[model samples]
Target: MNPGSEVVVTLRRATAPDARPAADVWLRSFAAALPTVVSPRSADEVRDYFRDVVVPLREIWVADAGDDGGGVVGLMVINGDELSQLYLEPDWRGRGLGDRFVELAKERSPVGLELWTFQVNKPAHRFYERHGFVAVEFTDGSGNEEREPDVRYVWEPKP
Candidate 1:
């Protein structure tokens, strides 16, 4: 394999050491993606939510850039059949990291996958759609903590 063409971004189960950085990724991407969507939680709260609730209950995966670059450029949170969260560093966008993460999610939940994103997050809509997810439902902000209008998307293996 050519050294220049080797893949830098790799995915693995997130460990305790990944908690802080993963939380940082989540917070940064969330804030950047949802500037117009009201969030009652601050950065600290977002971090704590990942460390306390998300990391404990879900399957957390991180995309590590290895020694040649800073580690953990992306993360995905999976809860059963749901792709609860997926985030990448601002610099990592458009670098195929999101598609790799979605492939990982598909590998984990081969039957189907589901996720919810704020209605204001247009980029997310585009990304998920590009990866074969379709909007299945929309809500008036009653089912989520942020109480923001949101949409649920689902993906299923092609028959």
Candidate 2:
């Protein structure tokens, strides 16, 4: 379904216990969103990362495309002031879920916000740019030596 024209996504606040399952979805959605191949994390590490990092900052949203068969199509992981992850299944991209998700996140974040996009993810870079996020910095080798550089974007919320 189209993001702006045809999807009815449901959103909810998640708890600490949700981090593992959510991160599981996050990793899968990440592979779906990007070309990178990644293995799933051990169950325990998933739980720990969620508890220590994902859950505490507390501005997260999970979405499902109306039908249960759609499974969880999206996951957004946010920190106190910045968005850490906003991933969706490929089928669900371009419908504007990413933009709406960030808006929801900005409502909860008390400070100006920022996000990092890999240089290779040109479509995503365009999506962020279209939504009024401006590139503030660039990093070398996509946060590592194997990939392209990372582009950082900043968003100053409207009053």
Candidate 3:
């Protein structure tokens, strides 16, 4: 697809078969977005986590591009009021897919939502801020698996 062109995708609840491809999107997105942070788990471990835990238990959604034969281009996981995970294919960035994922997250949890992103990810900060989230907390890498300093953002529906 050409840059800045509108790409179509269907967002739907992930099925058992979507686990691996969703994990691949997550892996690729993570690598591209946070090249400096070291991940605690290996690629195989991430895939296993998606298959065994995320797909089975979480409110996970995948942006499927199968209509155009692009497979799964992005994935989002919402856990309660937390937008636990949101990742898109590197090539799919700037195409508004992330905005769509955040919109779905808000629709799923209209009361509010919270998420954490590493401090180094400026693009993520801007993205979430644009979607109405405010940075509410900052920590010095004490409480996360990656031990990377991070910021917490929260969004509550307008009164």
Candidate 4:
């Protein structure tokens, strides 16, 4: 059986009530997947970042698990043409939800979209590559919080 078969995810604009849950998903997924690539933050710190900063500053869309499970299973933060962040609950990985979010980002920014991921994050490289993103630049560990080498990817719609 397909992992995504039982779970139906629906995307929705995030509300105030979604801040905590969405932050929880982000914290857990980041802790599990990006220990070497991203800097660590306390759960409270992440919650505050979401509630006080991200929720107010960015256009965030959440992929909520429908009747199958419950609660937000994924999140995408889009700031203009940049997909600033995208994360899914560990349990929700390997489903089509990430692909859906990328499609939505493309739809939202038809001209192009750009994102950055740690160079060490091979899975992310593959995922973005499969979604039509191409690596455009590489940066040493100078600009980001984690101080890890990173790669920038951009997606342009086929004309």
lDDT of 1 at 51: 81
Ranking by lDDT: 3, 4, 1, 2
* Error of model 2, residue 24, in angstroms: 3.1
**For this target, which candidate reaches the highest lDDT against the unseen true structure?**
3
lDDT of 4 by residue, 1-159 (tens): 357667567999898889999999998888887876656566898899999989888999999886457689899999999999999999889988899999999989999999999998899999999999999999996988878899999999999
Candidate 4 lDDT trough over 10 residues, lowest sum: 1-10
**How well does each candidate superpose onto the true structure, as a TM-score?**
0.90, 0.73, 0.95, 0.92
For candidate 2, the per-residue lDDT at 109 reads: 72
Q: What TM-score would you give candidate 4 relative to the actual structure? A: 0.92
Tens digit of per-residue lDDT, candidate 1, span 36-129: 7777888888778878877776799999987566788899989999998899988889999999999989999999999999998999999999
Residue-level lDDT tens digits of model 3 in 74-107: 9999999999999999998988889899999999
lDDT of 2: 0.72
Clashes of 4: 0
State the C-alpha lDDT per candidate: 0.88, 0.72, 0.95, 0.90
Ten residues in sequence with the least summed lDDT for candidate 3: 1-10
What's model 3's overall lDDT? 0.95
Q: What CA RMSD would you report for each candidate?
A: 2.6, 4.4, 2.1, 2.7
* True lDDT of residue 110, candidate 1: 100
User: Tens digits of per-residue lDDT for model 2 on 1-159?
Assistant: 455665567777776655665776766665666656333465567657767877677677777665543746678877767787887766777777777787787777746779887877888888888877899998885465345578899988667
Worst 10 residues of 1 by lDDT: 1-10
